[model samples]
Target: MNAQPLLEVRDLHLSVRAPNGNRAPVLRGVDLSLARGQVLGLVGESGGGKTMVGKAILGVLPDGARVERGSILFDGKDVLAMPGSARRMLSGKSMSMILQNPMTALNPVMRIEDQITDVLRLHMRMDKAAARERALEMLDAVQIRDPRRVLRQYPHELSGGMCQRVVIAIAFACNPALIVADEPTTALDVTVQHQVLRLIRDLQMKSQTCVLFVTHDLGVVAKVCDAVSVIFAGRIIESGPVREVFEAPRHRYTRALLEAAPRYDRPETALHPISPALREELTQEIVHTYRIPGHAV
Candidate 1:
């Protein structure tokens, strides 16, 4: 695996504008780096700025959110400094995102074939016929048995797993250098989730694609990520190799999250939530650090 970073986000601070015009901080000095062909997992509670990081990198921050201070570098190019055309060109073709809900991410009106071929047509500049053929090939690569019939089907006609497979096909169609998968399997059942995860891992390894997988599922992170970063309230509290972090978590939140996850072998182990004191201390640390000028957020 390449040691050089394909994507780097340093000291990123983002805020969402409230209805009253107040800028509420969302991501406070978020720092993340993903090397070529690496799988980096961003694990955190809901609303912990995991997805926001992905959105910021993809240059698709939701309305009312803006980056206050930070630098997002992709392949040594400054994403924040890029021209509008260049940024738009780089977004989907080189950096893509697999949203949490495929149903919402994909167009309900478009057929599966059209959806998958669109990326190839737009980015790869392939002719429609060639793009369609390549789309079929990609569908096959994603393990769809009857790619022909499925191509003609609409998103609503397919099962959740199948729809997600189509979404993956679209995401990987352009062979993006970096993929932000925001809980791609969150809506699927356990069996389907395992299959989807395996399929993603297989494709990622085959393409040597760098991926930043955002999820609250530690089990998924353990299975798929090369490195793991634990985020709490918008800050990365612990990060290292997956095995190292999982085997011995250094942060209270990380430890608590691990202990809280369900373990089949330990059926009697009750889930332990993080204590209120620990939460308070973590919040205090964030506040104190941010208050100190020149301190890393």
Candidate 2:
């Protein structure tokens, strides 16, 4: 028998309160799985529920959002069924998130040393001295220079790339089993983005951790992900090994997304955006599949 997946999401249907007091579906029966030490990419356009999937797994959905049905299982335990305290205990210790914006992710007023050490202290129960030492080690692991100096500085004192590195360091401080990286490289330039990607991949390999890398960039997925899932209108329409799916996409939407991305080999080629008719078809399909009246697409 195959070993159980590290993470499994099944028939997850979530909704948020709309302005008019109606619930709008955000995740429509979305299902996916991630094995230990694997990097799975969740790629889709804006407002396609990519980030929502990550949020649901982490149990950090917005205030107005609710999981109407389905389950999220981490390490064979039902995360959605766990109590608040149980979920909180699992969060920083076994599962952590690396958000899109490092500036907002890190507390501006706190020193870098305190930020990293706090998680180590809380999760690992390290004493003050031990936490401090481990914090420095975490910084060095992320390729930060002059770790001691950086420890004394605040978020504002570091460059954007450095701040992101610090955030990454914090996320990995507890050696969590799973990480949900939501567009972690979107805020950086090309060179910095590549470096951050490499750093994340290296650290993941060393730790043997699973990652749910959520991004709209196919290029980033191609570089870092072992498997790929294509989500559209809150549904996973296609998924498979990266090489197989990229070379021969079975879904029309998947083909459209691949075509939409820019090619390095053919720099002269113009981009082709997804057409409106396809979007409408997908929207209708979602409505038909769920058969729920007044379900927002």
Q: Which prediction has the highest lDDT against the true structure?
A: 2
For candidate 1, give the lDDT of residue 240: 94
Cα lDDT of all candidates, in order? 0.89, 0.92
Error of 2 at 61 (Å): 0.9
Where is the poorest 10-residue window by lDDT in model 1? 288-297
- Tens-place lDDT per residue, model 1, 173-216, is 99899999999999999999999999999999999999999999
Name the candidate that leads on TM-score: 2
State the displacement of the C-alpha of residue 21, model 2, in Å, after optimal TM-score superposition: 0.4
TM-score of each: 0.95, 0.97
Which tens-of-lDDT digit does each residue in 72-110 have in candidate 2? 999899998898999989975899999989999999999
